[model samples]
Target: MAGVSRYLAQSIVGTLRQDPTLNPLATLRAWPNLPAEALKRLNQADLSLVDRALEQGGWIWEPTDYPDNLREMESPPLCLFGRGDASALSTPMVAIVGTRKASSYGLAVAEFFGKGLAEQGFIVLSGGALGIDAQAHKGALAAGGRTVAVMGTGPDVAYPAVHKGMFAQMEASGGARVSPFPFGTPSFPSNFPARNPLIAGLAQAVVLVEAPAQSGALQTVAAALDLGRDVFVVPGPITSPAFRGSHGLIRDGATLVEHPMQVVEALGGGMIQPLPPEEGDDLSETQQAILACLNGGPMLTEAIVRQTGLSAPLVLAELTMMELDGIVKKGRDGYQRGL
Candidate 1:
């Protein structure tokens, strides 16, 4: 329903769902305001087949019942297909978006906010992109809270494909994979940009953890501003190109938030719990020794083994766990503290 106005699209979906005998074509054609493009696309295929497909797979959200915040968008979605319980959308949401090629620091920041906000009972919202977006989802799940993924493709097709397992877990855990794109829609370059507004509109605010000057996360920021929603940015290393857009947003008056609680509290969320345990607090003595070995800065595995006087195999195993826990992150030189 590309060019169809909100008024006509909702009426059609509402009517079509009511009675099977009501001719889809006749109902669609009756709308005097229906654009030629929308009418042509709707008429070319079998509406009965389309209706049946929608009925058989997952669920559909007509415009009439869209999330309240989402209805405020400049161009609200006409319909959405979802693969999990849509009730998660009713929770207060905060959008966290960043570059697909995220840095160690960026990933840490994304996950921190994700877990922090989720623990306080806000559902994290993001596009299911790689890097930052993926970590955000993982963080919420780690906290045993819900998260939502707004997809550029349809609900049935996980576009990057590597995220199939994560998508499955999201559905099983009450989070949703939602999209306005129809089933079988491919990953088009333009589709993501088109879907950014949905992310902005669905969340109370958007947090940009990291992005380059040209990163598309900025598009969501623009959409948030258009809808009069707040935009928050997590500052990254000033010298790095990946942070240029993030810093620019800060300089131009977007709120600079250092942690998830700041965003949550600003959005009026209750403090459900204190901050998560400090980094490295739960580590074994052996792990603490490994941490001490890298006090000067990042170091190679061999160097850490030599300094910690531990076996190389032991150091490797500990380092891997550290990376996964967001305690330390591997960089070009070696592993560095994620902070």
Candidate 2:
């Protein structure tokens, strides 16, 4: 309670009076006087445990240390618990979210955008859920860049449990996992919607990779729009139900992005320019042929092989190398020249 102001303590008491549960935003909204029981409950919280966890895993921060973008939110969290580099929270960020039940195409789009944006010095932010979110985090880590996973549970907890390794890697790579919730909080269904606003608040923009009509990703999009964050959607085939929400977003005026650079350019505020090829970065003959195949636009591996008369395996190998070399990028649609 050291950092808790008199007004905040009063608000917490007020919120508990209405519903025994603590609702941070509601507390901020109604600053009623502290009732005896609520005040006792507030005083009884185990501050020692929170302090030990903060000292052991990471640091705790108030609004002063929060990212300026997040702090501007109408109902920002009073305190944040974070692991890894706290500085990353202040950096320009892009949130990429989609269905937990993502398709291969959706995963690829998430990874492509995740890597592309991170390479340009933007921190990739996501929910750390499976499918698209996991791939997004993987892509940023693969690029040797930073990413921040805004959790729906406690900062110390990896909700799905499968992502504990990822949570460690993020911190090791100078990225972070953050939460507004206290330590030991479980991944309750209610926590996610509450967590969505933080994801939107931390980002300059939000990208919906592939969301179905009833997807949770759409909820994040709503929060992003409410926060005045730019929203971008990756268009998908009309035949696919997975794209229904994204297409609707496009129709409603969210920018449609076929490539990650479009998102970068759209959110421009001194974003780093794409690096020029280094000296002696000349392409081999096969590489040149593959590049030519993609000159028209992004093309599938099979299409590139057919156009360049290269074998399928050879094309795949070459494309993989090119992607690592930053010569080309692979998206849900296919491969295109890197930005």
TM-score for each model? 0.76, 0.72
Q: State the local distance difference test value for candidate 2.
A: 0.82
Model 1 CA lDDT for position 32: 77
| Cand. 2 TM to true fold | 0.72
Local distance difference test, each candidate: 0.82, 0.82
**Residue-level lDDT tens digits of model 1 in 1-339:** 557666777778788888988887787777777788777766664545456546755777877788778788777887787778789887788889999998767776788788778888888999998989998998888888899999998776786899999988888888988888775556767779989999998998899999899999999999999999989999877789999999999999999987677887788865443432364676778878887877899998889888878887667756755665567779999998766
Error of 2 at 273 (Å): 10
lDDT of 1 at 40: 78
What does candidate 2's lDDT look like per residue over 276-329, in tens digits? 354335677898888878778989888888888988766775676567557888
Off by over 4 Å in 1: 1-57, 270-289, 292-339
